[model samples]
Target chain A: MTANRPLILLTNDDGIHAEGIRYLTIAMEHVGEYWVVAPEAEQSAVGHSITLYDPIKAHEISKNGSFYGYGISGTPADSVKLAIHSLLPRVPDLVISGINNGANVGINVLYSGTVSAATEAAILGVPAMAVSLAQKKNPPFQWVVPHVERLALWLLKFGLPPGVALNVNIPAIPPEALRGYKLTRQRLAKMRESFEEREDPRGNRYYWLSGEVPIEESDDSLDATALNDGFVSITPLFYDLTAHSHLQDLATALKNLT
Target chain B: MTANRPLILLTNDDGIHAEGIRYLTIAMEHVGEYWVVAPEAEQSAVGHSITLYDPIKAHEISKNGSFYGYGISGTPADSVKLAIHSLLPRVPDLVISGINNGANVGINVLYSGTVSAATEAAILGVPAMAVSLAQKKNPPFQWVVPHVERLALWLLKFGLPPGVALNVNIPAIPPEALRGYKLTRQRLAKMRESFEEREDPRGNRYYWLSGEVPIEESDDSLDATALNDGFVSITPLFYDLTAHSHLQDLATALKNLT
Candidate 1:
């Protein structure tokens, strides 16, 4: 999975210490000159948010006495922005986020810090991609490493359009059991959430948000479905929020507004 | 602006106490039955994030000896989620977010907490709209009151397709100076950001993100342009991130992947 030596910026929502990023950093070394500017702590689910109200601080971090990169006190978007505009010696040729702990597919991608990191770069006119293991807990990330490298290399070679990124999810199966890649689209789906109401030691009642099950959307060509079927699902994603299909009709509808 | 008294869930990113929501809540009374479930403190730029790690807490609030609605210690998305799931007795007919402190036009909508609230409701199968004042400070939200009521009524009458939300931006002008409305698209624009390097009292160096100038994308039909021209800009936004245009091309490019 190793090739061109273009500079790459590596970051994740799982903080600088998560196993997903550490392995990803090691794998990226063969692909390019890589730098890691991730959050000092876990910043999961902090979508496309940036730190505007507070001062952002970052410093060099080392793993086992070897220089890894910088760890910042912010979200995934902040890390990427800070890296591109301030930290890195030069703007990287590509930005790759995660090897996230779980998949960012369907409507749930709206809350994904990993995907948002890549989305940030794409908005900044950089080619980017996000990799995730389909499993949520104790995902065997090693099974997805080579596949990640392969796709990342492909992104460098294939050069995505501006404001576009690939949201890639690999099925959490063993290497031998892994199927090939499948290009897919985000599913029209809903995540069923349940809150656990509890009383604290101080006698205050609180709610912990839990239980997200992807409910419907039975499209075989969709990202979630492709992942469920053991393929490396690559969904080409963009952030042009305009509902172009509804634009003209809406214009006509609102034409007579006072 | 008064019409059918539909049940509307009102929320904002600027906290419940902001003049924007206070005015919005009061204005909503003429249009429908409203319940304001919003963040206890300002939650600007907190995209679609929800509180998962911490237990969310919400309680009733009142203004001028009158009962308001619930305010929660969470993001705008969290407020909407908790409102829909646990706070409200039944699902609301429509959800309206903001009368935000600043314009959420162009690509900036991706990081807007106000828009995210409406987006969360839209994802949950409820019709939603987000209203933003083009001014960043001391915006005369009263100028927006009738227009907001108007468009909101239009939304109820001419319902949006599922997974879609209207991002509305009102020009920061007086009633007499206000131009009419325009149906616009989100501008493909970049916000030129500058970070200020500063020294703390303790002599530590940090960077504070400060400048954000919307640069380029000279499209007359864009939301930013319309607002700048003293018109109300209504943009139909849906968060299906799939890059459908590039899907087939990407599949062909990756067909021979090993």
Candidate 2:
């Protein structure tokens, strides 16, 4: 098992000490040598933010005098970028972000620092994957290790195509309760967002953002639908945001402006 | 002129009083009635981060005894979300973000708070646009006004397709130096990154992230190409990240695992 292990770079939106990344690193330990570079704080919905305005400090943490990980004072994407460019001894064969505490699905993926870490790696021409256990809170770590290990190994063996990254969401149920897995699309729906307004003692007003419910898409091909059906949903995502189909019509519409 | 004017919602990654957004509002004044909801401080490169852990305070500021805008103590995306959810009188007919001080092109859009604000508005089902005056430093605001006005008027007349947004980047040139506008794709290339290491007085080390020359995509239809050609680049972007063509192959690749 040690003869031909692929080098893996592991990161997460959750800080280096989160149970999710701890389990992910443990599960990955048998598969390959891993380098943990993650945020020092929870960066849940930070999206693809990078640190350009300020200096980033990477503090090396250790357990029992062995190399543990780097605690980066930045976002998830920053951790990955800093690792690949400055921290790692060499380029990793694969980059895995998460085994996140809660799921990242639907239009919510746009705000996910978990997915952004993997997406950042892919942007730098590395094979990347983002894994999340679907639940509002922490999923059972013991139940999630195998699912993460299997996919991490699979991705290493069968490399992803250029410009693509795998977004994997697993059901929170035990491994035995998992029905199967399916390749899916990002859903079209988003949070039915609302805010709670409050007045301060000084008569100033403030508000808190709240997502009461998700407006789910019913299509079976969507990640939301498959995850809801108790299946591991693997969605192949890319960074190309161009709506290719509309280019011609939009060009026609803007022709008169020139 | 105000009769039946389109109701516009204007926001920016730069604080409300940034000259870029100020010029944007001034240019947009004649076209429609607009509501400004922008970050209170520079939120450059924050991407799509939303404030979930803390309460957001929005202070309404008035100019010359009239309503100016809401100064939000959050990221660009948070301001847009808060405005739509709690501040705006009703759903805005259109949303426009930026007139950003720098170019948000190539693969760098992933880290752009300017583009994220517009993308957030589109996710909430409004027609939105993100406009940038491309430069390393502030571009001449006086020269950018007409470009902003013409496009704003054009979009108000011809609504954008659902879930789609226009990421517009104008070259840093006098209005007369402009060559025209082209519909383009986001480039595939990214920054060649490096880190500059420095030590504090206490001997603690830190690194500042820096980007060297861009690894440019040479395609003629790309945003980088258009901008380099002195043309305004209008890239039609969306949040759906699915790599549709790879879905079938990935499904086949993962068949043995289940």
* Candidate 2 pairs with clashing backbones: none
Measured by C-alpha RMSD in angstroms, how accurate is candidate 2?
A: 1.8
lDDT (0 to 1) per candidate: 0.86, 0.87
Model 1 lDDT tens row, A1-258: 224468889999999988998878767867888899999999988888988898998877898899988889989999998899888887788898998988888877889999999999999888999999988899998887788778778777878877899898988888778678899998877788877788779887678888888786778899999898888899988998899999988878886565
Best model number under lDDT: 2
lDDT of 2 by residue, A1-258 (tens): 124668889999988878888888888878899999999888888988999889999999886798889999999998988898888987888998987877888887888999999899888888898989887564787787887888887887788888799899988887777888889999977689899999999999999988648885679989988998999899999998888889999999998787
lDDT of 1: 0.86
TM-score of each: 0.96, 0.97
Error of 1 at B40 (Å): 0.5
Interface RMSD of the candidates, in order: 1.5, 1.1
Worst 10 residues of 2 chain A by lDDT: A1-10
The local lDDT score (0 to 100) that residue B40 gets in candidate 1 is: 94
Q: B1-258 in candidate 2: lDDT tens per residue? A: 124768888999988988888888888878888999999999998988888889999999888899899999999999989999899988888888988988888888888999999999888888888999878665787888888889888887888889898999989987777889999999977788888888989887788988657976668799988998899999999899998888888888897666
> What C-alpha RMSD separates each model from the true structure?
2.1, 1.8
**What TM-score number comes out for model 2?**
0.97
